[model samples]
Target: MKTFRLMSQIHLWLGAAFGVQVMLWLISGLAMVLIPIESIRGEHLRSDEPTPAIDWADRALPLAEIIDGQSLTVLSARTGMLADTPVWRLETPAGPVMVDAIAGQSLTPVSEALATQIALSRQIGLGEIVSVTSLDSPPREAGLSVPAWRIEFAAGETTPPTTFYINSRTGELRAVRTAAWRIYDIFWGIHIMDWSSRENFNSWWIKVTSIIAILFGLTGVYLTVHRLWMMARRRKAERLGGGGS
Candidate 1:
């Protein structure tokens, strides 16, 4: 009985303190489920055009010349298209960079025209270009650490507005965001209790809430079983008393 009372107290306090949090979880989880995962990935908006092949073996410049006297310590390198041009994409301690494979010139900080072209040629969907703008800091939606070119596109009435982020320097496709994706992202952020940076699931707030949630679950289970047991005992006693009468 004492244990039952303690369980009741814990359950009530848990509901008082964290019921709202649990409700938010339910709402967000439902929202996420209602929105298809493919939509979140912006699959419908992705460009149907196949990517252009790189001219790597023959015409493209050699690795040494691409690095040359820049004193660059090439940590990683690969060949890919930059706009219509073949280029060497590199990862350095400083940051990621790109070089024209044939011309052997740096393509870092590609011009706005090039960024727009990149968005046009390699973008994922049939979106008409809406606006091309630069951001000093990446938007939370982009999920990037570097500044980027924000390209807005207007799709048909059936589809929501979509934005693509291209690395301002490397011109790499960074992330895709649409109305559904953005809403889903918000719900996801709330679901994880990391409204500030939706990507972080390991925050101290989450840890504390997790402990609270576990306690709530355990106490609620105990309270429920105890109630059922008491009801059963009451019915048994009533039957015995009636039989004696």
Candidate 2:
């Protein structure tokens, strides 16, 4: 009886301490599962333009000539398009550099007009350019690296506000974030208890709350089993006393 009482007390106190966190975890987990990851990422909103075929017959400049004057150690090079123009994109020890394939001229530090055009080309729905900002540091989103252009778009009521991060030097579409993604991020932050970064799942607060929740569940189980055992004992005692009388 004393053990049962102690278990009940432990269960009650633990539940009181960690109930809100447990509820938050269950609700947030359900929400995350119900919502498709692609929807949260706003993939349906993007319209990827087909890559234009490179015309090799057009007397294109040699890769050596493009990098002749530049004092950059080339790590890798690939041919791709910057907006509508074909260029040789190079990864160097310093940073990414783009060279015009035909003119053999370097195209580093992409202009705002090009970035806006790139963002508009990738979007599908009705949206106007809200703002364009250059960022040297990563935003709240996870995949975006530094030295990029953040192009914001104000879409219709049904669609969420969208932001595209394009690599300034390589002109690569790095990441696309939307209002839905932000909503998911908020719940994720609450679920993980990493309010600041919204990424860390191994924080001390989460660990403590998890431990308390576990203890609460175990104590409740113990109390239930003890109560059943006590009830069985009482019934047996009554039956034996009646038989003796």
Candidate 3:
């Protein structure tokens, strides 16, 4: 009986203190699992164009000529397309630098016309071009670097807006954002209790709440088992008393 009373007190207090947060955790977890991550990221709206093949027949400019007067410390180099033009992309210590594959001319700070062409070519099911803004600083979305282009699509009543971020220097597609992504981000922020960054799962508040929730579950289990044992003993006692009487 004393043990049962102790368990009851613990269960009641813990539930009262952390019940709302526990409910939020369960609801947010269910939402994240139910919705496919790909849909949330708007991958369905991605361009279906096949990757352009590199032409080996075209004579590429000599590497020495491309880096003659530059003091760049190259990290890596690869071949890719920028607005349908083949180019050699080099990742240096400073940032990405582009050079025409055949002519070996430098191409940095991609022009607006080329950025628009690249964005439109990679996006599907988008309305007419709404706006293109160059960002020199990181936006709210995570994992994006500076010197990027934000291309936004018009929104309809039923269809929400879609935005694409492209690396202005390398012309690489960085990220895709849509209305669904924003919804997911909101719930994720609440779940992690890190509204500012939305990525810190190791916050002190979350750790404390999680510990309390665990204690609540343990006390509830103890109460359930104790109640069941007591009921069974009571039934046996009544049966024996009736027989002896």
Candidate 4:
């Protein structure tokens, strides 16, 4: 009886000590299993359409200089549908922007809107989840042949992170929600958050908490087995003529 009581007390204390940590692990693990990181980020938006035509490679203005004010970073050029027509591709704060070299005209206004969506998606990552991407499917249209290139914005360490696709011909913006590259974002988010992002996984506190929780589980199991053995012995002794009626 005394041994049983001691073991029970140890089990109780271990459970109490590690209860919160165990609960956290359970909750976070369940969340990850049920929810996809992409659904959490946002939905994919895609559109395809032919852009208005321009003379092949004839617009003589400085395409790079025109987009300088829109937070343009990476800039490149390619030949358009027509011979000698230059298709200008640029990365900007909003997203990617495409311009016509021959006509010296902006192709589409995808940059501003795309940048806004991506920014909103990141902010949503901070627990401000809105189900904006719940549309059944992204509307699809015909493909254009001006010039085509894909751009990827850095999705900080998670699977299915927000990505942008730019059509150099029409300057269209398509948010890429699913692909092989998206898996990286999921893993990254999990690693960075350490299964508990609210407390910031980069802190020393979580490391200590995790270690303590593991110890609690191990100790609790040992105490349980010890109590079971003592109970079995006591019951056997009682039956072997000591308390046999």
Q: Write the per-residue lDDT of candidate 1 for residues 89-118, one digit (tens) a residue.
A: 888888778888888888787778988998
Checking candidate 3 for backbone clashes, the offending pairs are none
Cα lDDT tens digits for candidate 2, 1-245: 68777888888889888988878889988878788998887788787654755675267777777767567888888888776778888888888898878877777788788888777777878478889998888576836665789888898567878888888877778788887788888889988999888979899998898799788889988888888988999999999999999
* Residue 22, candidate 2: C-alpha displacement in angstroms: 2.3
Which candidate would rank higher by lDDT, 1 or 3? 1
Q: For residues 1-245, what per-residue lDDT tens digits would candidate 3 score against the true structure? A: 88888889999999998988878888888888787998888777776434545563257776666666356877777777776777777888888898877777777787777778888888767777799998888587825766888888876444468888888787777788987888888889888988888989899988998899899999999998888999999999999999999
The candidate 4 region of ten consecutive residues with least summed lDDT is 134-143
How many residue pairs collide in each prediction?
Answer: 6, 0, 0, 14
Q: Estimate each model's TM-score.
A: 0.80, 0.87, 0.83, 0.39
Q: What C-alpha lDDT do the candidate models reach, one value each?
A: 0.81, 0.81, 0.80, 0.48
Model 3 regions more than 4 Å off: 1-3, 33-35, 48-52, 56-59, 156-159
Q: What is the lDDT of residue 183 in candidate 4?
A: 47
Give lDDT for model 1: 0.81
Candidate rank order under TM-score: 2, 3, 1, 4
Whole-structure CA lDDT of model 3: 0.80
